[model samples]
Target chain A: MRRELTISDQRIDEQALGKGRAMSAGMGAAVYFVGVVRATEEGRPIAALEYEAFQPMAEHQFHLLFDQAETRWPLESVRLVHRLGRVAAGETALWMEVVAPHREEAFAACQFIVSEMKRVVPIWKKAFPLA
Target chain B: MPVSVLVLFCSDQAVSGCYKSAVQVRVHFYSYFKDLAGLAEVTESVAPGSRLEDFLQKLFLRFPKLAAMKKSALVAVGIDYQAGDYVLAEGDEVSLFPPVQGG
Candidate 1:
């Protein structure tokens, strides 16, 4: 898989991230996971969320997680992009796409990537609850 | 006889024949810490041979509101995750991160 990890303060380009993967004819499945800023947290109404990151190290962790994902499954392509700074409720904060030859492997790898990213990445999100 | 001369530089006043100096460590704040601290970055001076824990202790002292997060927060020196006891160096970039909620 042509693995890529990107972190930016600007809006995430969904189309660009989901497109242009050189998938082999044999590879048929593609799975994507987009994490958005929810309107509430712990039952409290939220207005927005502000994201911050130790940029360099966060990128490093993303790359490391991709390596782990590749080792665990047979993947065709992968892309993980996360946005930093203020993200209003319902806006996309994270985008992940995993491509594999089969649906099972694609789903599993996609889930693994998101979980590992949350566990290890240095990025953080702060909620702004509504009054 | 050949002898090596050692140089000592102190920023604090010498007392009772003892010399003391403080090393300045620059810290960068993020997320809620930034909101609480009301600033993005600040520098704190600690005694020589101070560890990351000591710096954090001093930080919490200055910003008591941040104390609650000490247990879950992560520390990074430069671009790598560092243990609490990691010795801090002068001009080293120290970052305090709240428990990451990113996906």
Candidate 2:
């Protein structure tokens, strides 16, 4: 299966993740990363964070990141789901699943994808400070 | 000047004299800018061959507060980020986003 990348306003589905399990024989590790919306931002208490994305472009950028990761690591599959609209503090803002034959590459590629995703993804965040 | 009216007063010498026609760009704002602009999208006109920066200057003129984000804003036409010097074409769907803080 190919990389599954999505940008949506709904909450992330935790149960329907890591579908690449069937390929586990060839892939030894599945690294999952979850990015949460912090209770405070820049030292200020926050009620929640509002996330928005240029959908088409955000998806495009994530594809590029997937491509980048492929050349750098032998991966079985990649999955990324970023939330939109309002996300409460301590909630999942992002969820990523990276599958590879080795833990090193699985971890490295997972980190690389997130780093590159942050750099180029056309996703924006607005913090709502607690009054 | 209202951004809608400023379209007719383009400063780009490349097409300044030719006021007969102009390129219309559909602009969409995201995130911080979406709220700042108070509207999801708006179509703006600019001189033929006008660069993205030229159009942004006019946009800032209409919304002085947005000017503060001029340096940090990200511009994209279609699905790719575009440089300020990139020339805009007719009917282009332009998107402007403030510095992203996504994870």
Candidate 3:
């Protein structure tokens, strides 16, 4: 089992994620989400945003999240990535992929992962208002 | 000699504050507070029976920006967030997290 979770600002490698999905091809289906940086926040223009994380704890929590999903579902793979530092508009902010024995489980796990990540992770972001 | 509480900031500065001889607590900061305080952690001395809220009040007085964020900030002891009146013990790690809005 992989223990280190990828927490970064670099763009996600969809091909790699697809490969991971393919490894579990016969098992079921894969669900994925890519969060992109938007140009606006609350209807106001945003220039760029800064993301910071308490790395050690955040990584630990992420591993726990993955473990929980695996325990709750017949999942073959789970991949999650989040960006840190300053990100410009239209850039990717985060991505998550999960492969489960069925579409329903995959979909549910994907949603749960993203929502819980936002609610529990020690990562925070600050948006800069556009001038 | 009385046990002195040491508050260490990310800036590499350490401050000695009044603390009870029996308890040593570490406080950490995030987001704007980390930036403003120029430190990731602060150590403070507490009375033997100090409440978490009272310790926080002392912190707020020392760091005005931290005080300002109190309303919206979330405080956690180690991995769990505790209530204002939770009793602190020696070597407890307290974290101050600003509102999080990450995907």
Indicate which candidate wins on DockQ: 2
Model 3, range A26-107, lDDT digits (tens) per residue? 6668688989889998889999888898777788678878888888887787878888988888887887888777899989
Model 1 Cα lDDT, one tens digit per residue, A8-123: 88898778766665678889998989998889988889998888788888888788788888999999889878888888889899988898999999999999888877777888
Off by over 4 Å in 3: A1-4, A20-22, B1-20, B35-40, B49-51, B79-87
Give a tens-digit lDDT track for model 2, residues B1-103. Answer: 6556334545344775545567789999887787788888988888789898889899888767778888888888999988889999877988888876777
Clashes by residue pair, model 1: none
Best by lDDT: 2
Tens digit of lDDT per residue, candidate 2, span A11-46?
887777754444557888889999999899999999
lDDT (Cα atoms) of all candidates against the true structure: 0.83, 0.84, 0.79
How would you class the docking of model 1? medium
| Model 3: docking quality category | medium
TM-scores for all predictions: 0.78, 0.83, 0.78
Output the better candidate (2/3) by lDDT.
2
| Candidate 2: stretches off by over 4 Å | A18-20, B1-20
Every model's DockQ: 0.54, 0.59, 0.49
Score chain B of each candidate by TM-score. Answer: 0.78, 0.76, 0.76
Worst 10 residues of 2 chain A by lDDT: A15-24
Model 1: runs farther than 4 Å from truth? A25-28, A128-131, B1-22
What is the RMSD, in Å, between candidate 3 and the native fold over all Cα? 6.4
Residue-level error in angstroms, candidate 3, position A60: 1.9
State in Å the error of residue B85, model 1.
2.7
